[model samples]
Target chain A: MGDHLARAEDFENKAEKKLSGWGLFGSKFEDAADLFDKSANSYKLAKSWDKAGSTYIKLANCNLKLESKHEAAQAYVDAAHCYKKTNINESVSCLDNAVNIFCEIGRLSMAARYLKEIAELYESEQNIEQAVVYYEKSADFYENEEVNTSANQCKQKVAQFSAQLEQYQRSIEIYEDIARQSLSNNLLKYGVKGHLLNAGICQLCKDDVIAITNALERYQDLDPTFSGTREYRLLADIAAAIDEEDVGKFTEVIKEFDSMTPLDSWKTTLLLRVKEKLKAKELEEDDLT
Target chain B: MAASDPNKLMAKADKQTRLSLTRWSADWKSATVLYEQAANGFRVAKDYENAKIAYEKASKGQEMLSSPWDAAKHMESAAALAKDLRHWQEVVDFYRRASELYMECGRPQPASDALAKGARALEDSMSEEAIQLYTDACTILEDDGREQMAFDLYRAATNVYIKLEKYTDAASFMLRLGLAADKCNATNSQCKAYLNAIVIYLYAHDFIQAEKCYNDCSQIDAFLRSDQNRCASKLLAAYRDGDVEEIKRIAQSSVISHLDHVIVKLARKLPTGDVSALKAEDEEEALDENDLT
Candidate 1:
């Protein structure tokens, strides 16, 4: 009985080989279909899932030869699932193939579901970056599916990660430089002011003017509206520090400030400072007389 | 008075008058002979002014006597004397006179000879200042339908243009030279003009036009059996547009046999990739093959 079973298995293998060759070469639709079905059944009964999947793939190819696209796609999906049970790598590859096939067949949502499944798998692996990258790819694919809020959320995640990455990289350099300078100078008023100014610029890069002002006040007082002419105000601040009591010098600073057209609030505050210093100097001279 | 005695006195007076006439004829003949001697002496002494005057008087006297040979000879002598004295203007005048006399005397060869001499003298001593004279001579020759001689003057003018690098003018004259040579059945000179045109176009680097000229030269050389390598070289140089390898192939394969020195210089200046190692590898392979052998 065992010899008879072995003979039966040899006969099935020979029949499968003949069927595969016939499926490749036979031009008639009925013959090709019959051969492919025989090969697929033989592979399935032999417990060779990989070979079974390939036979199903060949069956799908035969369907494509017959221009039976719907049957071909079903056969490909079945083959993909068969490969999935054996290897996750093959499963992802087959899933990608099915997604492409679904996209080609204009079943974009089905294609997107396959992409989401892949992204979720990556996400479960804690490979959020790769998941985000694939999610962005799926969003591009579903850009026409406007009602798909999932794709929109994916796009938003991409933007949020991109901005966060840029901000993180920029903060590293900016904070390190500020910390080093502050330590070495012992945070003197002028040194603290320099650090604050640098920190303000960094905050501005981050679009956080509140943080910029808080940083600035650690060294010196910061005027509101320090957006456009902050550099000019800093120059005036330096001039005031150097010669605090000279009304003529303060008047010159005010004149220099006035010469700039379209002044921002920073320049306005600097002008006011110059005026107050000049007034204080005049009052002191009057007292001396 | 007796009749015989009066007749005798009249005869005697007639005899005396005849003797005086004879003496005067002799004196006139002697003076004519002396003028001939003086003209020949002045000509031999290189005194063209005196020779011209003496020859003029001798010619007149011979004309009065209806001595055509004497008149022709004296006029020819005067022309020769003027030519020998390098008096070109007077030489042309004397030559014209001599030619007219020779033609009148029915010596057409001598007239033709005298005219040719005058034309040659003008050509030899011709200067830029004498352009009008040259033009006049050319006009006369052309009006007489002597285009071959006119082409000589044209060629001379072309030489002036060549001196000035007026290639277009030189080419124009060269074309005229070809036409004149064709008219005169002078194939050799026509071929020379065609060759000259090819050279001009080659110098101008006008290859397309030069190719046409080269074809003409080739056709001429076919019958003349002359080597056209020089012209072919020029054509190659004008038509060549690439590096030395292409030029070398063309020069080697075409009728042109010589390599251009400029091409050689340029090839030397071109950066050659170092291939000695590659060649060494080939040599090693050859050595290995020999060892196996």
Candidate 2:
């Protein structure tokens, strides 16, 4: 590590000197970039991420001086990966710098791709706020690039985390919009039923009796075929139970739905929220008695 | 020429619609008027689908003519037809179109009103849409310097969270309401918001946040002098002692319950049946889980 650092300093000092044609004022970034790249590789061999990362950053600067935008962005991305091993915030900053360069060069697709990497990194770190921001950016870029599948995939992540953050309306809107687009294209139209069901669950929590019933009719309109699906019926039954203020009926309806297709924990948690309203109503009734 | 002849009326309306559209390519005002007449003709003939289509056509023509108010009206008519047919998504879309038209006219109040109608219709079944409509309306109003309306809408949003049993979030929103109220010199509203925040935080079993809420509320003149606030102090003492009945007494006291119905309901669910030692039991359970893990 010490030998690599000494050699890296020697390269950097030489790289910083002024160039004057012929021998380039006794300096040449082409050699300097090469030397920095070597130092970075040696640091990687020694498993010193900190050293490798900084050296790669220097190499990236060298690549920038050579007017190789793509190479410069790639080196920055490499540096980000090395920084990610021990210091996540540093990794994020490095990746942001790379993305900025890519964005500046009109390489939207590449920028979007790296943005998704950053989002995934944030997700792994449980920095949900940052993850949502990057995912949203990636989704937008992918959508602009006509990469529909990747855009929707990123949108799903945004929706899921938004729900986790208790921003239910934001999550529901994303699902509903994507589902409507799918229905119109007759592409995976059958999937709209689940999306409507998720929207219903979000609605059920909102304490708006008006919105829940009205949503049922709207779902039928959004995806006419959804009206006949098991999930649709399940949502209807739950809404009915809410109207009746029947906890037993609500539980039974949920059980019946699970029988059709077992409820995952996420779905169960959502149902529990609906059941909470029922609990309060039942208690109020008990108090009256 | 019989007024009650449905088939003839439909035929005449359709012909006029085709002629007006084909012949009046350069005159949008006339086209809009003709389309509206056609829409009414179709409505009289009980041809709802065609009526909606004609109304939509009229809306488009009016929009092109830069008559946004007229465009919004036609779109609203189309929305009514769609609503009658139970085409709820179309209803929402038409309302959104109307709102957008109003926005194009630089009429924020009418735009907000249009969204509120959509919010009302969707609030029962699609709360997310309802919330979005309300949020968008509030954003427009807020940007237009209608801070009172914005604060009220935010409070409404928090009320929805409370109904959903999301106490921590409800409290956070209430805090926002309190801050906004303070800025506007709505002293009573400010204290109510802060007290509401404290109750919600207490319900959430987050003592630190509840204390912070209490401190904030205590500074408010309305809270300092009110009977409810006095009861709230007693309620806090009950909570510390884990006295379920004492907590209930203070909560159910006449003055406190009227301040917020949702809080009492939330408090009912707060009791764990073993109120002897609050923090110790939870900590021990945590340790037990950690050991298992």
Candidate 3:
């Protein structure tokens, strides 16, 4: 490792010397960039991530000096990969550099792609807030470029994490919006039910009766067939239980639901929360009566 | 010797038990799902009662799994069905329950939001009930440090009181609102609350209370003192002189007038210095005071 680092330093010196040599601007800068790239490769081979990152950054600088912004961005991206192994903050900074260069060069897709990568990196690190931010940024770019699928995919991920973090209202809004979009498009109509159900479920986390009623009415009218579906029925029954303050009734309805199909844990958790409240209300009602 | 092949029989029995257990679980799951579907079918058929019951059953499935949020969603669904049925009491109860669930889940804001819905569901039904729910909601929001939400709810309750011709009740709520607004340094709202209290008190024919609220409101709001001091003084003068006609004319022409025309007209029709209505109002106030004590 030491020998490889020494070799990297030697190559870096040669790159600097080349930059000061009497040659054409492109040739001299390219030579320097090539030598720096070799140094970065050597550092990487030696498993010296910090050294490799710095070398790649130097290579990027050489490319920038030559006014080859695209090449500079690629070098920055390479530097980010090296930085990922040793320093997360540096990795983020490198990725940011690449994004800035890519955006400046009108490579919006590239910028967006890097942003998604950053989001994924943050997700893997369990920095959910940062992950949401980067995913939103990526979604924004993709949306701007008319890449509907990519934008929606990133948005779906954001919605998923938002819900997991208990930002239920926001997740609900996002899912409903997606559902509406799907409902409007013939190709995507088939997927609307899933989104609508998700939104309806999230509505349970909110106390907006008007909104819930509006959503129900909207869903009922969306298709006559939808109203007959199990999802709609479950939501309707739950709403009834809430209104009646009947824990026993609520329990019976839910029990009936479980007997038909298994519930995912997330759905189960929210349902139980509603049930507990109903029981409390029942107790209060008993006292009132 | 008689228990020969005991291991083989035990193995067979164990296998039978495991198979039945799996089947039982599957049956439970399917039945639960069928109830969910049946609820939806009933909703589609506009059979609200059946839908409400079905949702309750679905929620029970979630409860068995100990899923709080999911269970809460079922109650929300039931509430929706009840709303469709125009059953205000049921809607309020469901929302109340949902709020508790949200609170239990460590989400106070959603808890308060659920109460807000409950309050709304009660709004167009029974005014007294609505007022109570709104008060409950405001208290929750206030305890949660959501001063703005609390203030909004109290204001809403006061409006409802006014609409119901419960002038004295409105006056009390407005006074409470003024105090809350003062604490938040919401000068405009504080002054407005005090002003509203003054008007409501006068409409209720509680002259002494009206004068007191007027003075208190003027002290807190310079704009009132600056713009409507003359109006207040003239009304007081008419009241003191026992000139019922003058009182009616001045109150009608006052800048701060635009109070409930019905109450003002009713006040005008009463005999001079009779004050029977005022006495009735005082008794109500006394009853409220006793309750507080």
Candidate 4:
């Protein structure tokens, strides 16, 4: 009878060996998880947390393959707890994996808890932002943790988050302060008059007359002796673009030219021509009057 | 036994003895005197043949002394004797010898004179031979790089070419004359040659090629003004003729800025009827009659 049973079970035994071989090489997590889980209970009964954790990791991987997000997260959490007694680092690493999986599954609150744990572990290892981030999440998970009072861990997480936020804000402030100092140095080296004139032109283009005036005022303050011919010309162009009678703009152009100590003869001639034309227009206006 | 008779007889005896002695010694001076005396005696007797023989002996004696001038004189006498004797070849030979000796004496002018006389003698009998002689003489001077002499030769040759109505060959020689002038850096001569070439082309009615030569001459600094005027006039005439070739020629020629300005001015004036005056002046010329009509 034993010989007959061995013959009948021969194919079944071959199939099991082939399945295990396929599990090792096939990269199919579902197949590998089924094979391991079938053997996991035995390992668990044998009080093998290591094997159980390994099987749970494989189960979590299989659940990931099936896109069963909650099950995969839970499995990774169980694996982390199992690995915790043996190696905290390995447990944190497993928790990291669980956090990532939970995040992918829209389990932000769970990911925040894992982040807090990882942050605490890293902070203890002197990682600041990571601890701050987990601390921030602990606050987010306050209602989710379902405790009567906030845990001390949660409270510590909040304080740390607050300190980290202040540190970050101070860092931003310091960056802005340094930027302002560099800008001032640049202005001292190469006068900001040209920059302000350019800013005035930009503001004029944007129809920001007040900003243009402010920039022009700043430009004059920086460069008191600046010739405003180009600015006056731009103003005239803007006035013309707006279909305004811009004799004042032209007058400003002439004033800018006249302000020079040794006026360009060509410019003087051109200004005389403009003045003559204005005189002719004024005479015609008087005749109309 | 009178003094005069004895003296005369002694003189006679001395003469006879000197004559015998001169015959024995074969002295050239005595021989010349004897020969002259014999020729005079023969002439007195009208013995023409002996007179000739006496002159021959004198010539032979002179030749024996190896004096070139004397030999040439003797040879000339021989030629005269041969001419009298109607020995034409001997006459030629003697004249040739005399000429050769004169040339050997570095007497080119005399040698040339003798050669010309010789050539004249041969001219009717062998005109081509006379020409060949002249050509040979010219080659000698040419080989010596005597340009003036060569130019004379070329002029002579050009005359010959013209006689033959070989104008192309004449022009070619004229071109050589120009080349010689160019080698001497005679810009005016080069310009003249170029002008002559233009004339040749124009006579051939090769207006385009004539214009090309004109332009080339114009580029020469020596002829610039004349060539410019010539070329511009030709261009204006060509423009009137509607000659596409002449127009193309002018277009390929140098651009005179002033002329371009004038043309532009004329173009501008045309619309206002201002160019009519210029047109009327052009019409007055006989060449523009066709256009006017």
| Candidate 2 vs. true structure, TM-score | 0.46
Residue B214 displacement (Å), model 2: 76
Q: Please, what are the lDDT tens digits per residue for candidate 2 over residues B69-180? A: 9899788778867766767788789989999999898988878767766765675566667667767877777677665656656665565676566777788777776776
- C-alpha TM-scores of all predictions: 0.29, 0.46, 0.45, 0.25
Off by over 4 Å in 4: A1-289, B1-63, B73-95, B120-125, B143-146, B149-154, B157-293
Q: Give the top-scoring candidate (lDDT).
A: 2
Ranking by lDDT: 2, 3, 1, 4
Over the stretch A1-289, how does candidate 4's per-residue lDDT look in tens digits?
Answer: 4443343234334434644565543455555556555554444555556755776777777777666778888888877777765666777788888877664443546776776676677677666666666665554454333221333345444443433333323332322233222232312323333333333333443443454455455544434323333544444454343233245665665565347634445334434444455556567777998
Model 1 in CAPRI terms: which quality?
incorrect
Give the Cα lDDT of each candidate: 0.53, 0.74, 0.72, 0.50
Model 3 has a DockQ score of 0.01
RMSD values for the candidates in order, in angstroms, are 51.0, 29.1, 25.5, 51.4
Is model 2 an incorrect, acceptable, medium or high docking prediction?
incorrect
- As for candidate 1, its clashing pairs are none
Q: Report the candidate with higher TM-score, 3 versus 4.
A: 3
DockQ of 2: 0.01
Candidate with best DockQ: 3
